[model samples]
Target: MRIKKYSFLLLALLAISFKSFSQDTTQYIVANRKNSLAQQNKPYVILISADGFRYDFAKRYNAQNLLRLGSEGISTPYMMPSYPSVTFPNHYAIVSGLYPSHSGLVNNTYYDRARKDKYLMSNKAKVADSSWYGGAPLWVRAEQQNMLSASFYWVASEAAIQGVRPTYYYIYNEKIDMHNRIAAVVNWLKLPPSQRPHLITFYLPQVDHAAHLNGPESPEAEKEVHFVDSAVNELQKVVKTTRLKNVNFVFVSDHGMTKVDNKNPIGIPAAIDTSKFVISGDGILVELYAKNKGDIQATYNELKKEAKDYDVYLKSNVPARLHYGTADDWHNHIGDILLIPRAPKVFNLWNNKKINPGWHGYDPTVVPDMRASFTAWGPAFKKHLVVTPFENVSVFNLISEILGLKHTDKIDGTNQLANKVLIKKASKKK
Candidate 1:
């Protein structure tokens, strides 16, 4: 195990000088690219994300397909997402091995002081722009080494970060049915070895939409969980027709959802002065960006004075363990002042719009409900294994190890997860 890791680590680092672009496009491809002969033979990985799937959803909803597959492989009690466990940040964290703060995606919608612009998840222009993203995402790393990748829709998958997007990918769209999506994967697998994707990302959004619209405990949420379970079972069965070997599935969720106190939500804090600071964030958390750095302390103190259901802090004092403080904000995009509400309470900035019943974006360390789910099943994994909860960043290490792709940059994740869940042979390249 050590030998394989050491070999990958010792190789001369690669220096890339190419440029790429990603606009409002779908069924995208990077022309003239073919997986290196060495990479064409690597084991296949289908990384699927069932958004808002709680750790216990399968068992609670009796998702027999997922339960059986998980029992046949490895399932952790739960996987802790990074602080402020929201979709975009945590999903990007999973692929990049960097916390949301480190990755510069502090929230689903955040203002970058340097760029003087806000990146909203709803804005397709910003979503497709690679400049907002940081760190070497899994697809970027794979392509850097000449291994092709594909994505059906996941955070940063559409952006051409580091001048590389997945070789085959579609921009985010909800219109595609499960039948067509599975067929696309099947077709990709049937491609010639050199043209086939070694790494593919497939996302399922039904669970999250239901959980957010109706409370996670509601019938609609439970129905979506079953839907995802049946969908995965169908996907696996269809892929089996190809009779291909070494196809692995890492079923995961970005973050879990919990019922919040929407009826009596906290309004915008009186301490915030618009002239002195710019504001961002929503019900789960509120961020105040100070126009002048010296004003931060006073605002933080004032917010603390009026603070009731929420906790206020200067960016410098954000919990060190959460890696969200000023020191850890690699992209300088984090707000100067942050307000984190206690669970069941969320910040209502406008004091007008109705808040959702189910919500996330709390520190997972303190709110267990924010924790996500993870299960590894396939030819590359050891049979019937269970391990303790791990951080979402650890997934970056696991994928690289499985595909024998070397990472030239430093990452927050380590080989600990890969070593524990993957069999020894996983480290040895085919």
Candidate 2:
């Protein structure tokens, strides 16, 4: 009996030792796997912006390429644009991590009396000024982190903002060949993984061009959206079938278009003192350069009282709900006051019988008119997941999450979608 008891005690001690050793080994393995995953999950992020694409239009017009991309990954069903709901303001909002007002891109064209200059983001000269741009784009941020970055045709790309330039970019070519654009991107991806870009932006203007030329509902517009879809599909094929390695893709648009039934004039040429406000190109938006500080409110109130055909508000009086940055540097580029008309109504300054088809720049609060198209796919995204009613600011947060980087600037968005979709559940909880 003594011998049997001793034997049992020895076996128990050995089993206990083995159990502790096994626990230690399991913990180490788990930790190492997590570390490995962290290293492996760094993704090459691609941002695709198909200008003027509406939310419902994607499904209504049967965008098979977009639908297929969604089927292969995750998408936010209907993403709304920033206030004013114009392409320039909203697209600037996405990459800069700021709203239109905060980013100093309140409208496509706005007046600034301080420098006695008119700021148009499309103007290469205006964009060249770093102070004019509100914040750093992801490309500049990536460069700061010593990661490779490039842009195919994003706004402010040609500008030297934040003292950083993309590794590769086009010079705002309106007549750029789509195939050549795709080939340039593919060539960049073909570089060695170490030298390859971590972030890239692809802008497809054909759809937006077609939409503006042939109305968003026209068969020509449908064909344009499909053309973009085909391009996106081609990109998918290149990324999937190649040795490009780990990657992530985000597809988005600046704003949706609305059909106009009336020639609604937001402001009359006779209403504003023409000497004070030169009707800028494309009368859809106007810039008022105050001759002096005293002239600011006068110009503002005059337009407000007389331009009843539009909704006029001062840049200083911009709605707090929009979350514009309060810094002094950002305010100068904004007009003393902005004018935007209600839907089915467009600003009358730019009415050229030659250039009418479809348009944007309506108030963002109007839901049906404000909705834009967006989708995210690839290894970093969850397959076939649906996210609804997220804000445009959420995009910045999502991109930061994919690269395993953190941005402390308080934005209107978060990385909740990534956690909801991409993060894998632990088999057993800690």
Candidate 3:
């Protein structure tokens, strides 16, 4: 009889211990979440994308603050980019939940010389025309569902290229107005809870700018990261004080940078007759629009076969695996062919500068070329968890889950994976 009683006591103690552990884990997750004034709070989602941010740079620089979020929440081992892995292409992927090809943006710029129009990324005359865009971005989707959304500096945020505009948006300008852009976001959050957007996006371009000029590991790049980090920390403080505890912030980047090797020049003489084609932009990649398609094939062919130092392919033949498909919308409409130079080297045709320090747009498949990092922390996530390799599109699916919105089309990513980032699993299933 005594043995039976002791066994029961032991079992009860074990149950208590397990319950304690479970509670501890749950508390840990909540501790990281911003506190709220009310018992029930609306969920919030914030996405911050840093241009030209590479994955390993986080480790190399000992980004403890960033790693803390990952350790406390879920993080992707390596997130692949959409084909062409450039800023515009991959940024479109993050919000649309589609790869670059499907999103209709293939490169930074596209040339429709035949129509006498060039698709450059400026706010001047851009519109949310249906022809140039594909699928809906997170803001558009949220707006369709009658939810509020906002964007700071995403590529399409300025143009409203798809009939979907954020509740608030800013014109894209890196130097003229970046802080004001961030201020607008904070101001929106200060509005009444009902008026505040459930979804918000913010972009920082300084890092990419420094990287392009000084190389990825240069002192300028370090300063850019730290400056951005300070800004992010400030934003976090604001969320905690405001009634914005419901917000779930996600920090991510478009792609990483590779050092330029100026040793060998892939000599494809300028194909433009100057009278027929116009060239724009400077650096590793040059944007050109030709009045004649005939020259495009010859120029493209030579770049592919003879241009050993560069990986050249026409818009149609861009590798499918990159999720960058043939031209279907405005994003992919311009470039007839893309020239991606390998690492330790970047292309230079436009002013033909002797050497360029840094570059992106390489095939993401090059393991060393993959850039960017992702972190999330909030009630909507699964805490202290590690997710397997994921793609930028997954972020869209995850946001949908947090907001309880439905996206009808099939996307490359899923909320199921993102859920692993901020929430804690119960010790025992109910």
Candidate 4:
């Protein structure tokens, strides 16, 4: 009788401990998910994003590990960010193969017309609400096909997009140490084949945070760059312990950063009537969401006339290459008028005494400094190959091709990028 009682107490204690562990991890694991037989044998991909890591960061900072790894496989001169060159938008673009305008995450902060709510990156509630997001991210794509995925951190990765989240994901937080973050990914790789994740996304925000706090070229930002570089190297070393033969890595940045003229920031345009138009955006890009449809034309005309240093454009007149105008605004998140500032100058609606010296959110085509970085190294990629610059949207197609996942959703990325970087497969994935 005593033995039975002791065993019951032990079991209860174990259950309580397990629950405690799960809560500590802050991980949300979907129940009863296992990769399909075909998916089980597919190659593994770990997509890493270092926010605000510029195209020249590796070379400029001498990130030896990254330079060496990039050389081991395929890399590009630079990767163009989707229109608006901001964080939330471009990160979603890389995973979803849809430009931010098309995906509804048109900016770091955008006002959704239909719902009449704002999606601010800093608002924890909105950032986690899946309704604010649309594009079928890579993890969502993999989960739909019964291939498990994991995310250390990625925009919208915490949200359940299309009724699915990565099989193993954490509600993004900065508390976890970089070493522990990489360990979690390694642990995912060490899981049993039937339950293991085939797709994983890891994000590092140190570089971006430092760059924003101090100019991108500042010593503080450079130290963070080296930290990220070493972290990537450490992750690769840890991943090898799993001995998973086909593990692949793709390193990229959401957008690049630049030093802006924060001392003499431009105030809200004199022509803008706050009551008539809702203002959104930061630093380099300013958007005007008109309350009344009729007000758009008149307001745009006024802003265009008074515009100095910044160029004003009607949504329709925005350059077609940006894919961000009325025609491309699939969810109507874009404003009727866009105010684009030349580099070194940004808008300050709040009339703040000072703003951060580093900023992005510019048109990459115009401000070459806004180009993001991309490099891929794996058994699947060609070795020591350099390619021309490609749009960030194409990263989605490249990973999709690698995992052999078929995406029925409409996407802006083409298979051309995957073809150029990836090696010809000996046999198609079943």
TM-score on alpha carbons, each prediction: 0.93, 0.81, 0.78, 0.93
Local accuracy of candidate 3 as per-residue lDDT tens digits, 1-430: 0122332232222110001111111100101122223312447788898777787666666666677767776677667776666777688889888776566565555444445554444323432344556777888777666667777657676555555577666545444344555667678788675566778888877777777778788988888777767677777766777755466778888887777665564543444344544543323444445567677887776555666655666767766665543544335344565665656555445223355566676667774555567777766676787777677888887777676667777677766665565453311111
Residue range 297-334, candidate 1, lDDT tens digits: 88788888999998998888888988989799988988
lDDT tens string, model 4, 305-366? Answer: 89888999988899998998989988989988899988889776444535777888888998
Compose the digit string of candidate 2's lDDT tens values, residues 147-265: 66778767677677877777666566545467767777777677665556677898876666666667778898888888888888888777765565567788998888767643444
Model 4 error, position 39 (Å): 0.9
Off by over 4 Å in 1: 1-26, 427-430
C-alpha RMSD for every candidate: 9.8, 21.2, 18.0, 11.2
How many backbone clashes are present in model 1?
A: 0
Q: After superposition, how far is residue 413 of candidate 4 from its true place, in Å?
A: 0.4
Q: CA lDDT of 400 in candidate 2?
A: 68
- The deviation in Å at residue 382 for candidate 2 is 1.6
Cα displacement (Å) at residue 239, model 3: 0.8
Could you tell me how far off, in angstroms, the CA of residue 162 lies in candidate 3 after the best superposition? 4.0
Ranking by lDDT: 4, 1, 2, 3
Give residue 217's error in model 3 in angstroms: 1.0
User: How many residue pairs clash (N, CA or C atoms closer than 3 angstroms) in each of the candidate models, in the order given?
Assistant: 0, 3, 24, 0
